[model samples]
Target: MMKIKRKSLFTVFLLSMFILSIVPMSAENVEIYSMEKLLDMYIENSHDIEIMELEYELTELKYQIESDDLDNKERQMTRDKDDFYDTKDNSSSQKNIDEKRDEYYASAKAYAASTKDLMIQEFEIKNQDKYVANDTAKKKNSFKNDLWQLYELDKQLEVLNATSDLYKSKYEVAQLSYSLENMTESDLNQALIDYEQMVLNSDTLINNLDMLKGNVYINLGIEPEGEPQFDIVPPQSISPVNITYNDLLSSHKSNSLDYEKQSYSLEAEKVYFDILAGVFLENSDDYQENLNNYKKVQLDFYNYEKELDQMVLDVYYNYQKTIDDYNYAKDTVELAQRQYNEAETAFEVGQISALDMDGAKLQLLNAELTYDQSLISCAKATDEIALLMDGISIK
Candidate 1:
């Protein structure tokens, strides 16, 4: 019997382990979706936000219970007297109880009303209508911004693909150049190096494309299988305008979600102080406890203000960097185009050897890649700034 029981337990343990092993451990579930659809699903399924909502509901319920207890004050007083008093003095004590009950009823009603009001206020703070509206708008903007970014990334990938083709052409040219008996060992070595570099670059581009596709799948809640197609329309080009540090700071202050949340936090802390000082003062054991709570609120309020200021500064700096990078990339692309033109002219004139021309072509390709990469960096930086300002799309 003992042996059988042990065998059964061992079997159950093995089964449990097998089940655990089969369960999906990676949070990176694949799914296909548009940017808007993905954001909607994320908002609906956000466990953290739901938990906050549950806490608010629980508070409302607690307030209701207190309200009910207050309403039953008279009945409770009568029950208490019945349990304690004898029939003889009961009539006299009943008169005393009636007076006490009226006083208790008035106080209970006041307390219940106050508690209900505070609870409603807390609910408003937790789910402020204006804040909720702002948050929703922010989330929507963020989604649109992300979509723009994805579009930019797609363009970069296309550029990389084009560059890869250029590399293939260069490799072919190198082969032809090496076929010439007049080619020096140094010339052949340079050709080989150019071909190898192009191959490596093409491989890097393919890897990046794969990674971006995976991210898109995850964002859309789709199963990632086979080749992913990203249809991204580039935004209309905007002229480069001089934007100052102050302008960036202003933008961040107006748009940053983190800053807005911190502002709300400060307001909440003030409300907490008011409640602790006004309502909870009487309930507190001593002056010391009240003083401690007051100090804590002050400290929290100070910290929140500091945090908001720092966030504003950080976002402003990031935005500036993004703008600078975009400008630099624009210049680099122009330079690359000029170089490619020069190389083509040189190759046609036969002034430069095929190997040298190929080297120049590879250089132009690298420059173009760098320019595309910079463009991506700028877009990402813009998205980050938007998110900070609370301008992102949220459901």
Candidate 2:
């Protein structure tokens, strides 16, 4: 009986160990999406993009049918012409040859009409595809903007929560001092007010955080309650744009939606002008109107090129400003660290009170938070330039 009891106890111990091992694995199943993964998920779940893609597919299918019809018309026209020639060679009757010739001419006219219709259809399909692509780019930009805003709010919450702890600590110390008759009642009351205010601010931040998270979940087609918790680790160090200004400009020129659209319009206008020149006099109203349109598009194309250059320059300057801000913040942190070290030494030597040391520590915390905020701003600025260069724009 003793041996059996010991065996049972050992079995139970083994089972307990196995359960503990499995618990962590189950807990670890909670997915933590990085920023890139979050962006991917957001894009993947976008209803607007999905709808745009569906519409584009339908447009392509419609155009495909029209294109096939055009091919069939061409084939039929060729066969009719071939039949006309065959009749000329074999059918010596003048009436039959005349009928075949008329049939061939009618088929050619029909083919030309179909060909014109297909040209318009093909252009519509191309324009719709461009719209879908542009809309998707805009959605990606919107997602990045939203994510950056959330990240900024999260950083604010971090600072506020840290400040709350400091406030709570100060209030507790103030109460102890009041009890010992070392602090005035008024001062203790002030400390309590500060701590309560901190709590209120923290609560407000929490509410804002939750609201933003819910908005993000809704955008991602996810239920807030069922979504796995995630974290965003802000960039810790400043990353300078490594490319030259000329390189950035080149990319912007190549990828600019405005440029591409304007260029397409300009070419189309030139084609229209040629058609008008073939059909009408230069002084004719229709020809003049089309010529004006062609020149206007040419002017627009030139203006947009200049605008793009300025935009690239502006982005570069803004990125530089962020780097400067980060550098300044880093200096402030160094100063705060020195102050903290001095406060620590003074407190150890009984030269200052605990509350004074805490004040220095809070300053250090605030300075570090400022530095972190600057770093994130710098990173965000860098990313914005990259996106712009990558052809992301609303227009």
lDDT of each: 0.52, 0.67
Locate the minimum summed-lDDT window of 10 residues in model 1: 1-10
Error of 1 at 217 (Å): 3.6
What alpha-carbon RMSD in Å does predicted model 2 have with respect to the real structure? 13.5
lDDT of 1 by residue, 55-89 (tens): 55666676666656654653554554354343324
Question: What is the TM-score (0 to 1) of candidate 1?
Answer: 0.53
Best by lDDT: 2
Tell me the alpha-carbon RMSD of every candidate. 16.1, 13.5
The sequence of per-residue lDDT tens digits that candidate 2 reaches over residues 260-358 is 666665565565456445433468775576678768878887887788778778887888888899999999999999999999999999999877887
Candidate closest to the true structure, highest TM-score:
2
lDDT for residue 53 in candidate 1, whole number 0-100: 60
TM-score of each: 0.53, 0.65
Candidate 2 positional error at 194, Å: 7.1
Q: Which regions in candidate 2 have their CA more than 4 angstroms from the true location?
A: 1-32, 61-145, 161-201, 226-230, 255-258
